[model samples]
Target: MTRPLRLHYAPDNASLCVRLALEELGLAYDSVLVDRRAKAQKSSAYLAMNPNGLIPVLEIPQGPMFETGAILLWLSDTYGGLMPAPDDPARAHAVQWLFWLANTLHPTARMLFYPDQYCDGDAEGLRRTTRQRLSHQLGLLEQASHADWIDADGASAQGCYLGPLLRWFALYGGATDWFALQRWPRLLAFAERAELQSAARKAASAEGLGPKPFSAPIHCHPPEGSAV
Candidate 1:
Protein backbone atom coordinates (compact mmCIF):
# COMPACT_ATOMS: atom_id res chain seq x y z
CA MET A 1 0.00 0.00 0.00
CA THR A 2 1.15 3.54 -0.66
CA ARG A 3 2.16 5.43 2.45
CA PRO A 4 -0.26 8.06 3.57
CA LEU A 5 0.90 11.64 3.99
CA ARG A 6 1.48 12.68 7.60
CA LEU A 7 0.86 16.29 8.52
CA HIS A 8 2.43 17.76 11.64
CA TYR A 9 0.41 20.79 12.57
CA ALA A 10 -0.81 23.19 15.23
CA PRO A 11 -4.37 24.40 15.00
CA ASP A 12 -4.81 27.56 12.92
CA ASN A 13 -1.13 27.84 12.06
CA ALA A 14 0.36 28.06 8.57
CA SER A 15 -0.30 24.36 8.46
CA LEU A 16 -3.95 25.17 8.04
CA CYS A 17 -3.22 26.17 4.45
CA VAL A 18 -1.54 22.86 3.74
CA ARG A 19 -4.36 20.99 5.41
CA LEU A 20 -6.85 22.73 3.16
CA ALA A 21 -4.87 21.80 0.08
CA LEU A 22 -4.77 18.16 1.12
CA GLU A 23 -8.49 18.12 1.68
CA GLU A 24 -9.22 19.95 -1.56
CA LEU A 25 -7.15 17.43 -3.43
CA GLY A 26 -8.91 14.58 -1.67
CA LEU A 27 -5.61 13.13 -0.52
CA ALA A 28 -5.71 10.86 2.45
CA TYR A 29 -3.52 12.07 5.27
CA ASP A 30 -2.97 11.64 8.99
CA SER A 31 -2.70 14.49 11.48
CA VAL A 32 -0.15 14.56 14.26
CA LEU A 33 -0.57 17.65 16.39
CA VAL A 34 2.54 19.60 17.26
CA ASP A 35 2.10 20.88 20.79
CA ARG A 36 2.73 24.60 20.58
CA ARG A 37 2.35 24.99 24.36
CA ALA A 38 5.41 22.78 24.78
CA LYS A 39 7.26 24.20 21.78
CA ALA A 40 7.25 20.77 20.24
CA GLN A 41 8.16 22.28 16.89
CA LYS A 42 11.60 23.02 18.25
CA SER A 43 12.10 19.53 19.49
CA SER A 44 15.10 17.67 18.05
CA ALA A 45 13.02 15.33 15.94
CA TYR A 46 10.96 18.09 14.39
CA LEU A 47 14.04 20.25 13.85
CA ALA A 48 15.76 17.43 12.02
CA MET A 49 12.85 17.37 9.55
CA ASN A 50 12.55 21.15 9.35
CA PRO A 51 15.63 23.04 10.46
CA ASN A 52 13.51 26.11 11.00
CA GLY A 53 11.31 24.21 13.48
CA LEU A 54 8.14 25.40 11.84
CA ILE A 55 4.74 23.83 12.14
CA PRO A 56 3.05 21.87 9.30
CA VAL A 57 5.67 19.53 8.07
CA LEU A 58 4.20 17.08 5.56
CA GLU A 59 5.88 13.74 5.76
CA ILE A 60 5.91 11.91 2.43
CA PRO A 61 7.75 8.84 1.19
CA GLN A 62 10.77 10.82 0.06
CA GLY A 63 11.08 12.72 3.36
CA PRO A 64 9.49 15.54 5.32
CA MET A 65 8.60 18.70 3.43
CA PHE A 66 8.54 22.17 4.96
CA GLU A 67 7.19 25.56 3.87
CA THR A 68 3.52 25.94 3.18
CA GLY A 69 3.77 27.60 -0.25
CA ALA A 70 6.19 25.04 -1.60
CA ILE A 71 3.94 22.26 -0.40
CA LEU A 72 0.83 23.83 -1.87
CA LEU A 73 2.46 24.46 -5.22
CA TRP A 74 3.81 20.92 -5.28
CA LEU A 75 0.44 19.45 -4.48
CA SER A 76 -1.26 21.51 -7.14
CA ASP A 77 1.29 20.54 -9.74
CA THR A 78 1.37 16.88 -8.80
CA TYR A 79 -2.33 16.30 -8.16
CA GLY A 80 -3.71 18.58 -10.92
CA GLY A 81 -6.10 20.91 -9.15
CA LEU A 82 -6.13 24.26 -7.33
CA MET A 83 -3.81 25.66 -9.99
CA PRO A 84 -3.58 26.29 -13.66
CA ALA A 85 -1.57 23.50 -15.21
CA PRO A 86 1.92 24.21 -16.54
CA ASP A 87 0.80 24.41 -20.17
CA ASP A 88 -2.09 26.74 -19.53
CA PRO A 89 -1.50 30.32 -20.67
CA ALA A 90 -2.79 31.64 -17.37
CA ARG A 91 -0.29 29.51 -15.54
CA ALA A 92 2.33 32.23 -15.75
CA HIS A 93 0.19 34.72 -13.90
CA ALA A 94 -0.74 32.15 -11.32
CA VAL A 95 2.84 31.10 -10.61
CA GLN A 96 4.06 34.66 -10.29
CA TRP A 97 1.24 35.69 -8.00
CA LEU A 98 1.74 32.56 -5.92
CA PHE A 99 5.36 33.59 -5.42
CA TRP A 100 4.25 37.08 -4.47
CA LEU A 101 1.95 35.61 -1.83
CA ALA A 102 4.69 33.37 -0.47
CA ASN A 103 7.51 35.90 -0.47
CA THR A 104 5.69 39.16 0.15
CA LEU A 105 2.30 38.91 1.81
CA HIS A 106 3.12 35.95 4.00
CA PRO A 107 6.28 37.57 5.42
CA THR A 108 4.46 40.83 6.08
CA ALA A 109 1.95 38.84 8.14
CA ARG A 110 4.80 37.26 10.08
CA MET A 111 6.05 40.71 10.95
CA LEU A 112 2.63 41.77 12.17
CA PHE A 113 2.18 38.64 14.25
CA TYR A 114 5.75 38.62 15.56
CA PRO A 115 6.97 42.19 15.26
CA ASP A 116 9.50 41.73 18.03
CA GLN A 117 11.36 39.21 15.91
CA TYR A 118 12.18 41.92 13.39
CA CYS A 119 12.55 44.93 15.69
CA ASP A 120 14.89 46.09 18.46
CA GLY A 121 12.05 47.20 20.73
CA ASP A 122 8.84 49.08 19.89
CA ALA A 123 6.99 45.94 18.82
CA GLU A 124 3.65 47.71 18.86
CA GLY A 125 5.05 50.44 16.69
CA LEU A 126 6.32 47.78 14.32
CA ARG A 127 2.81 46.34 14.21
CA ARG A 128 1.45 49.75 13.31
CA THR A 129 3.91 49.99 10.47
CA THR A 130 3.26 46.41 9.41
CA ARG A 131 -0.47 46.97 9.45
CA GLN A 132 -0.16 49.88 7.07
CA ARG A 133 2.02 47.77 4.82
CA LEU A 134 -0.44 44.92 5.09
CA SER A 135 -3.26 47.26 4.19
CA HIS A 136 -1.43 48.38 1.09
CA GLN A 137 -0.71 44.78 0.22
CA LEU A 138 -4.36 43.87 0.48
CA GLY A 139 -5.31 46.87 -1.59
CA LEU A 140 -2.92 45.71 -4.27
CA LEU A 141 -4.55 42.29 -4.15
CA GLU A 142 -8.02 43.80 -4.28
CA GLN A 143 -7.12 45.48 -7.56
CA ALA A 144 -5.18 42.61 -9.07
CA SER A 145 -7.61 41.76 -11.82
CA HIS A 146 -4.81 40.20 -13.83
CA ALA A 147 -4.13 37.50 -11.29
CA ASP A 148 -6.21 34.55 -12.46
CA TRP A 149 -5.08 32.65 -9.39
CA ILE A 150 -6.96 35.12 -7.20
CA ASP A 151 -10.20 33.55 -8.36
CA ALA A 152 -12.85 33.99 -5.66
CA ASP A 153 -15.66 32.15 -7.37
CA GLY A 154 -14.07 28.78 -6.78
CA ALA A 155 -11.20 27.07 -4.96
CA SER A 156 -7.65 27.66 -6.16
CA ALA A 157 -4.21 27.37 -4.61
CA GLN A 158 -4.17 31.05 -3.72
CA GLY A 159 -7.65 30.84 -2.25
CA CYS A 160 -6.56 28.08 0.08
CA TYR A 161 -3.63 30.20 1.23
CA LEU A 162 -5.48 33.49 1.47
CA GLY A 163 -8.46 32.18 3.44
CA PRO A 164 -6.45 31.56 6.59
CA LEU A 165 -4.61 34.84 6.19
CA LEU A 166 -7.86 36.78 6.04
CA ARG A 167 -8.93 34.98 9.20
CA TRP A 168 -5.76 36.00 11.01
CA PHE A 169 -6.20 39.61 9.98
CA ALA A 170 -9.41 39.65 11.99
CA LEU A 171 -8.33 37.59 15.01
CA TYR A 172 -4.68 36.80 15.54
CA GLY A 173 -1.54 38.34 17.14
CA GLY A 174 -2.82 41.61 18.63
CA ALA A 175 -5.42 44.28 18.13
CA THR A 176 -7.41 43.56 14.97
CA ASP A 177 -9.56 46.66 15.32
CA TRP A 178 -7.64 48.15 12.42
CA PHE A 179 -8.46 45.18 10.20
CA ALA A 180 -11.74 44.46 8.50
CA LEU A 181 -12.48 42.16 5.59
CA GLN A 182 -15.20 44.52 4.43
CA ARG A 183 -12.59 46.89 3.07
CA TRP A 184 -11.84 44.25 0.45
CA PRO A 185 -15.32 43.32 -0.62
CA ARG A 186 -14.12 40.90 -3.28
CA LEU A 187 -11.89 39.10 -0.84
CA LEU A 188 -14.57 39.18 1.82
CA ALA A 189 -16.93 37.54 -0.65
CA PHE A 190 -14.28 34.98 -1.40
CA ALA A 191 -13.78 34.29 2.29
CA GLU A 192 -17.46 33.80 2.91
CA ARG A 193 -17.72 31.33 0.06
CA ALA A 194 -14.44 29.56 0.79
CA GLU A 195 -15.53 28.74 4.32
CA LEU A 196 -18.59 26.91 3.06
CA GLN A 197 -16.64 24.66 0.69
CA SER A 198 -16.09 21.03 1.57
CA ALA A 199 -12.32 21.28 2.20
CA ALA A 200 -12.67 24.28 4.48
CA ARG A 201 -15.60 22.75 6.36
CA LYS A 202 -13.54 19.66 7.13
CA ALA A 203 -10.53 21.70 8.09
CA ALA A 204 -12.57 23.95 10.33
CA SER A 205 -14.20 20.98 11.99
CA ALA A 206 -10.85 19.28 12.62
CA GLU A 207 -9.18 22.40 13.96
CA GLY A 208 -12.14 23.73 15.93
CA LEU A 209 -12.19 26.86 13.77
CA GLY A 210 -15.99 27.08 14.06
CA PRO A 211 -18.35 27.64 11.12
CA LYS A 212 -17.59 30.73 9.03
CA PRO A 213 -13.95 30.47 10.00
CA PHE A 214 -12.75 33.06 7.56
CA SER A 215 -15.53 35.61 7.06
CA ALA A 216 -16.19 35.56 10.82
CA PRO A 217 -13.02 34.88 12.72
CA ILE A 218 -12.45 33.24 16.10
CA HIS A 219 -9.59 31.88 18.09
CA CYS A 220 -9.18 28.15 17.61
CA HIS A 221 -9.91 25.65 20.35
CA PRO A 222 -8.40 22.40 19.14
CA PRO A 223 -9.10 19.10 20.79
CA GLU A 224 -5.41 18.32 21.25
CA GLY A 225 -3.20 21.39 20.88
CA SER A 226 -3.05 25.13 21.45
CA ALA A 227 -3.24 27.56 18.54
CA VAL A 228 -0.77 29.92 20.12
Candidate 2:
Protein backbone atom coordinates (compact mmCIF):
# COMPACT_ATOMS: atom_id res chain seq x y z
CA MET A 1 0.00 0.00 0.00
CA THR A 2 1.18 3.56 -0.67
CA ARG A 3 2.00 5.66 2.32
CA PRO A 4 -0.16 8.76 2.67
CA LEU A 5 1.32 12.24 2.26
CA ARG A 6 0.43 14.98 4.70
CA LEU A 7 1.36 18.66 5.15
CA HIS A 8 1.19 20.91 8.19
CA TYR A 9 0.51 24.45 7.01
CA ALA A 10 -0.59 27.95 7.98
CA PRO A 11 -2.57 30.13 5.64
CA ASP A 12 -0.55 32.69 3.62
CA ASN A 13 2.67 31.29 5.01
CA ALA A 14 5.61 29.72 3.22
CA SER A 15 3.69 26.45 3.27
CA LEU A 16 1.62 27.83 0.43
CA CYS A 17 4.55 27.16 -1.87
CA VAL A 18 4.67 23.51 -0.89
CA ARG A 19 0.93 23.21 -1.34
CA LEU A 20 1.28 24.64 -4.82
CA ALA A 21 4.01 22.15 -5.65
CA LEU A 22 1.92 19.23 -4.43
CA GLU A 23 -1.05 20.39 -6.44
CA GLU A 24 1.07 20.92 -9.54
CA LEU A 25 2.52 17.45 -9.22
CA GLY A 26 -1.00 16.03 -9.02
CA LEU A 27 -0.27 14.50 -5.61
CA ALA A 28 -3.19 14.07 -3.26
CA TYR A 29 -2.02 14.98 0.23
CA ASP A 30 -3.90 15.77 3.40
CA SER A 31 -3.43 19.24 4.89
CA VAL A 32 -3.43 20.00 8.60
CA LEU A 33 -3.85 23.64 9.54
CA VAL A 34 -1.35 25.00 12.04
CA ASP A 35 -2.84 27.73 14.20
CA ARG A 36 -0.23 30.46 14.20
CA ARG A 37 -2.56 32.78 16.07
CA ALA A 38 -2.60 30.31 18.96
CA LYS A 39 1.12 29.62 18.71
CA ALA A 40 0.47 26.01 17.84
CA GLN A 41 3.67 25.72 15.85
CA LYS A 42 5.63 26.25 19.07
CA SER A 43 3.80 23.47 20.84
CA SER A 44 5.64 20.27 21.72
CA ALA A 45 3.76 18.17 19.19
CA TYR A 46 4.57 20.38 16.21
CA LEU A 47 8.13 21.10 17.41
CA ALA A 48 8.81 17.36 17.44
CA MET A 49 8.22 17.38 13.71
CA ASN A 50 10.07 20.67 13.13
CA PRO A 51 12.28 21.98 15.87
CA ASN A 52 12.31 25.44 14.34
CA GLY A 53 8.56 25.78 14.86
CA LEU A 54 8.07 26.76 11.28
CA ILE A 55 5.16 26.18 9.02
CA PRO A 56 5.23 23.48 6.28
CA VAL A 57 6.34 20.15 7.64
CA LEU A 58 5.72 17.42 5.10
CA GLU A 59 5.07 13.96 6.52
CA ILE A 60 6.25 11.28 4.17
CA PRO A 61 6.55 7.55 4.64
CA GLN A 62 10.24 7.92 5.43
CA GLY A 63 9.77 10.72 7.91
CA PRO A 64 8.72 14.36 8.29
CA MET A 65 10.69 17.04 6.41
CA PHE A 66 11.02 20.71 7.38
CA GLU A 67 12.40 23.71 5.51
CA THR A 68 10.57 24.91 2.45
CA GLY A 69 13.43 24.55 -0.07
CA ALA A 70 14.37 21.10 1.17
CA ILE A 71 10.78 19.92 0.94
CA LEU A 72 10.37 21.27 -2.60
CA LEU A 73 13.65 19.75 -3.76
CA TRP A 74 12.82 16.40 -2.22
CA LEU A 75 9.41 16.41 -3.83
CA SER A 76 10.89 17.23 -7.23
CA ASP A 77 13.51 14.50 -6.97
CA THR A 78 11.11 11.87 -5.72
CA TYR A 79 8.31 12.71 -8.15
CA GLY A 80 10.66 13.37 -11.11
CA GLY A 81 8.94 16.42 -12.56
CA LEU A 82 8.71 20.23 -12.17
CA MET A 83 12.51 20.26 -12.19
CA PRO A 84 15.32 19.57 -14.57
CA ALA A 85 16.65 16.03 -14.95
CA PRO A 86 19.24 14.93 -12.40
CA ASP A 87 22.05 14.71 -14.92
CA ASP A 88 21.02 17.74 -16.88
CA PRO A 89 23.54 20.58 -16.87
CA ALA A 90 20.82 23.07 -16.04
CA ARG A 91 19.93 21.15 -12.90
CA ALA A 92 22.70 22.79 -10.90
CA HIS A 93 21.55 26.24 -11.93
CA ALA A 94 18.01 25.40 -10.96
CA VAL A 95 19.11 24.13 -7.57
CA GLN A 96 21.18 27.26 -7.00
CA TRP A 97 18.15 29.47 -7.65
CA LEU A 98 16.12 27.48 -5.14
CA PHE A 99 18.77 27.95 -2.50
CA TRP A 100 18.99 31.64 -3.33
CA LEU A 101 15.30 32.04 -2.80
CA ALA A 102 15.37 30.11 0.46
CA ASN A 103 18.42 31.80 1.94
CA THR A 104 18.18 35.33 0.57
CA LEU A 105 14.70 36.24 -0.53
CA HIS A 106 12.72 34.35 2.08
CA PRO A 107 14.71 35.56 5.07
CA THR A 108 14.67 39.13 3.82
CA ALA A 109 10.92 38.91 3.55
CA ARG A 110 10.66 37.58 7.09
CA MET A 111 12.60 40.55 8.38
CA LEU A 112 10.27 42.92 6.60
CA PHE A 113 7.12 41.15 7.76
CA TYR A 114 8.22 40.50 11.34
CA PRO A 115 10.84 43.06 12.19
CA ASP A 116 10.01 42.89 15.87
CA GLN A 117 11.16 39.28 15.94
CA TYR A 118 14.65 40.27 14.89
CA CYS A 119 15.23 43.22 17.15
CA ASP A 120 13.56 45.28 19.86
CA GLY A 121 15.12 48.60 18.98
CA ASP A 122 14.42 50.73 15.89
CA ALA A 123 11.86 48.43 14.32
CA GLU A 124 11.04 50.96 11.64
CA GLY A 125 14.71 51.43 10.81
CA LEU A 126 15.14 47.72 10.44
CA ARG A 127 12.17 47.55 8.10
CA ARG A 128 13.52 50.39 6.01
CA THR A 129 16.90 48.73 5.67
CA THR A 130 15.36 45.37 4.86
CA ARG A 131 13.09 46.92 2.27
CA GLN A 132 16.03 48.64 0.58
CA ARG A 133 18.03 45.43 0.55
CA LEU A 134 15.10 43.50 -0.84
CA SER A 135 14.66 46.06 -3.57
CA HIS A 136 18.28 45.72 -4.59
CA GLN A 137 18.05 41.97 -4.58
CA LEU A 138 14.90 42.07 -6.66
CA GLY A 139 16.60 44.38 -9.11
CA LEU A 140 19.37 41.84 -9.54
CA LEU A 141 16.83 39.11 -10.08
CA GLU A 142 15.03 41.19 -12.70
CA GLN A 143 18.25 41.73 -14.59
CA ALA A 144 19.09 38.04 -14.44
CA SER A 145 15.76 36.82 -15.73
CA HIS A 146 15.04 38.28 -19.14
CA ALA A 147 12.26 35.81 -19.79
CA ASP A 148 8.98 34.79 -18.17
CA TRP A 149 10.53 32.51 -15.54
CA ILE A 150 13.89 32.36 -13.79
CA ASP A 151 14.85 29.34 -15.81
CA ALA A 152 14.88 30.15 -19.51
CA ASP A 153 12.97 27.03 -20.46
CA GLY A 154 9.87 27.37 -18.29
CA ALA A 155 8.44 27.38 -14.79
CA SER A 156 10.12 25.33 -12.05
CA ALA A 157 10.28 25.19 -8.26
CA GLN A 158 12.08 28.54 -8.33
CA GLY A 159 9.11 30.20 -9.95
CA CYS A 160 6.78 28.42 -7.58
CA TYR A 161 8.71 29.81 -4.61
CA LEU A 162 8.93 33.31 -6.07
CA GLY A 163 5.25 33.78 -6.82
CA PRO A 164 4.04 33.93 -3.23
CA LEU A 165 6.97 35.96 -1.96
CA LEU A 166 6.45 38.58 -4.62
CA ARG A 167 2.78 38.85 -3.83
CA TRP A 168 3.39 39.14 -0.10
CA PHE A 169 6.15 41.65 -0.57
CA ALA A 170 3.97 43.83 -2.69
CA LEU A 171 1.02 43.54 -0.37
CA TYR A 172 2.63 43.66 3.08
CA GLY A 173 6.21 44.80 2.80
CA GLY A 174 5.22 48.49 2.60
CA ALA A 175 7.14 48.94 -0.65
CA THR A 176 4.21 48.84 -3.00
CA ASP A 177 4.44 52.49 -3.95
CA TRP A 178 8.14 52.37 -4.76
CA PHE A 179 8.45 48.74 -5.90
CA ALA A 180 5.58 48.81 -8.33
CA LEU A 181 5.19 46.13 -11.02
CA GLN A 182 6.00 48.74 -13.61
CA ARG A 183 9.58 48.91 -12.31
CA TRP A 184 10.04 45.13 -12.49
CA PRO A 185 8.12 44.23 -15.61
CA ARG A 186 9.76 40.88 -16.17
CA LEU A 187 9.33 39.75 -12.59
CA LEU A 188 5.77 41.06 -12.62
CA ALA A 189 5.02 39.15 -15.78
CA PHE A 190 6.53 35.99 -14.30
CA ALA A 191 4.41 36.41 -11.18
CA GLU A 192 1.33 37.03 -13.28
CA ARG A 193 1.93 33.80 -15.18
CA ALA A 194 2.59 31.86 -12.00
CA GLU A 195 -0.64 33.19 -10.51
CA LEU A 196 -2.52 31.91 -13.53
CA GLN A 197 -1.31 28.31 -13.08
CA SER A 198 -4.09 25.93 -12.07
CA ALA A 199 -2.21 24.46 -9.14
CA ALA A 200 -1.15 27.89 -7.87
CA ARG A 201 -4.76 29.00 -7.97
CA LYS A 202 -5.88 25.91 -6.04
CA ALA A 203 -3.20 26.35 -3.43
CA ALA A 204 -4.05 30.03 -2.95
CA SER A 205 -7.72 29.14 -2.56
CA ALA A 206 -6.87 26.40 -0.07
CA GLU A 207 -4.97 28.96 1.99
CA GLY A 208 -7.92 31.38 1.83
CA LEU A 209 -5.64 33.93 0.15
CA GLY A 210 -8.12 34.41 -2.68
CA PRO A 211 -7.82 33.55 -6.39
CA LYS A 212 -5.96 36.61 -7.73
CA PRO A 213 -3.18 36.68 -5.18
CA PHE A 214 -0.87 38.51 -7.56
CA SER A 215 -3.35 40.78 -9.16
CA ALA A 216 -2.93 44.56 -9.69
CA PRO A 217 -0.79 46.47 -7.24
CA ILE A 218 -2.48 47.62 -4.03
CA HIS A 219 -0.12 50.59 -3.26
CA CYS A 220 0.05 50.29 0.52
CA HIS A 221 2.07 53.19 1.85
CA PRO A 222 3.80 53.09 5.20
CA PRO A 223 2.17 54.90 8.13
CA GLU A 224 2.79 58.63 8.51
CA GLY A 225 6.11 59.62 10.15
CA SER A 226 7.17 55.96 10.03
CA ALA A 227 10.79 55.22 9.06
CA VAL A 228 9.79 52.76 6.35
lDDT of 2: 0.78
TM-score of each: 0.97, 0.89
Off by over 4 Å in 1: none
Q: What digit string (tens of lDDT, one per residue) describes model 2 on residues 1-228?
A: 877899988777788789888988999899887877688889999999999998889999888999999999999999977678899777877788788999998999999988899998988899999989988999988887422245343457887788888878877854456557668877777767777888876876565555567655333222111111
Q: Pick by TM-score: which candidate is best?
A: 1
Clashing pairs in 2: none
Candidate 1 — which pairs collide? Answer: none
> After superposing candidate 2, which stretches have Cα over 4 Å from the reference?
145-148, 151-154, 174-176, 217-228
lDDT of 1 by residue, 1-228 (tens): 778999999999999999999999999999999999999999999999999998879998878999888989988998888888999888888887878888999999999998888999999999998999999999999899777545556688888889999999889758999998999988887888899899999999999999889999888877778998
